[model samples]
Target: MKKVLIMIGNIALYLGVFYALLYLLRSTYNYEATQNFAKFLDVNPAMFMVVLFTLITLVYLIIFRIKGWIWPQEDKNLFRAAGFRRLSASRVLLMIALGLAGSLFSIGLIVIDDIAKQFPSIPALVDDLIRGDSIWYVILGAGLIGPAFEEILFRGLIFRELRRVMPVYAALVLQAGAYAYFQPSAALSVISIGSGLIYGVLYLRTGSLWAPILVQNTAMSTIFLFKYIGFYEWFGRLGDIWLYIITALCLIALIGGSVYVWRTSGNGGIGEQANGSTKGGLTV
Candidate 1:
């Protein structure tokens, strides 16, 4: 409980740093530009915030290493400790497939909400980004930088820490909760948390940050692409019946992919270490 509390505190501190940097950066622009930029920031504050925080985290890691302050029990290599190890090509493809399915599954929420006459409220920044001409920034921020830092913060740090004290499933749930809390809105929160669960499982099974990172990148990239191409509005235009059918099909795909992974991959599920200790949430 104490550790959990500390983790929550660290999150608050991280958010504080993000807001401070955002304000400082925004202040440099003129009033009209600043207002526009602020809207862009709202589209996905996490994307920009993670850029600065990721750098800060890297520096902290370097200092901790130099001072021999970081725990030695974990792997000495930062990347390995963060689960950036190699996996078979097939495994990578499987991970991506699962990620795609998970993403499609999550869109069901949006369809349902739209039908309920409660379409998810997109962030003003996102609205502005779509209205404007340039979307390379959105692609870069949402697709790559956002997922990279998010995987580092959530799966690499928070989930890894929680696994030391609790069951893998419990840790996954806790980290998913954190993921949801950080999202822009209630609708997004639901999608993010659901996706986070699948990503958590992948990370634990493969012991690779790349797994979750790639999965995240795929999901975000797809959403950004869809949004930019106006697919979201098109989907909305499909009416309740079509949306329900699509959502049902999406759910089927999600479930089928999950079951396929479980049956085919030897390490798709969690395992315990030989020493009866939990390592990478896998049992050996």
Candidate 2:
């Protein structure tokens, strides 16, 4: 419980620092000035967040190193503790497949006209990015940087701590809940919980942070790509029967892919060492 409290405190501190940075930026330059700067750089205002988040991640890495979180001893690097390890080529392929299928499946669920109407509308930040002219910036920020940071924080840090004190399944659920709760809106929180679970499973099965990172990055990038290509609009235009058929196909693929990955992950159970532990005294 003490450890969990410390973990929660760290998360609070992290958020505090993030907002402090935002405040600093706001104090340093007015909104109009920042907009002008973004225009000068041929980017949108979202670039500020991209740069700010990148800095925060770097700062956290430095703090981890200084606190012996990354390199606790000569023999054991805590990067492995955070699920940074090599994966088999086959496992990598499976992870990619699951990630893609998961994204498609989630999209299929929300695109149903009834379901879409019931949920809260998309968050303004995401909507702005989708409508913005800077495609590459959105891809770099949302697709890559955002997922990397989230995987590190949620799966690498929070889930690691939870696993140390509870059952693997419980840890997965807790971490997913935490991740979902942090999202900006109810609709996103709903989507996040499902993705968070998939990401957690990927991390555990592959015994590598790269698994979730790759999966999440792929999922996000694909979403942006679909939006850029007007895929959602086109799909919406299709007849209801066709929409249902395609959604069903995506659902089948998602389930089949998840099962295939689980079975192929070998005899390791959810509580196996590969879930979040290293032989060299590293417990992720």
Model number with the top lDDT: 2
Backbone clash tally for model 2?
1
lDDT tens per residue, model 2, 168-222: 8899999999999988878889878877887787777656788878777777777
RMSD of 1: 5.6
TM-score of each: 0.71, 0.79
lDDT tens readout by residue for model 1, 205-250: 6656777777777766676677777777777777777777777786
Task: Please report, as a residue range, the 10-residue window in candidate 1 with the lowest summed lDDT.
Answer: 274-283
Give the Cα-based TM-score of candidate 1 against the true structure.
Answer: 0.71
Regions of candidate 1 where Cα sits further than 4 Å from its true position: 1-50, 63-77, 102-113, 122-133, 233-239, 262-284
Worst 10 residues of 2 by lDDT: 275-284
The alpha-carbon root-mean-square deviation between model 2 and the true structure, to one decimal in Å, is: 4.6
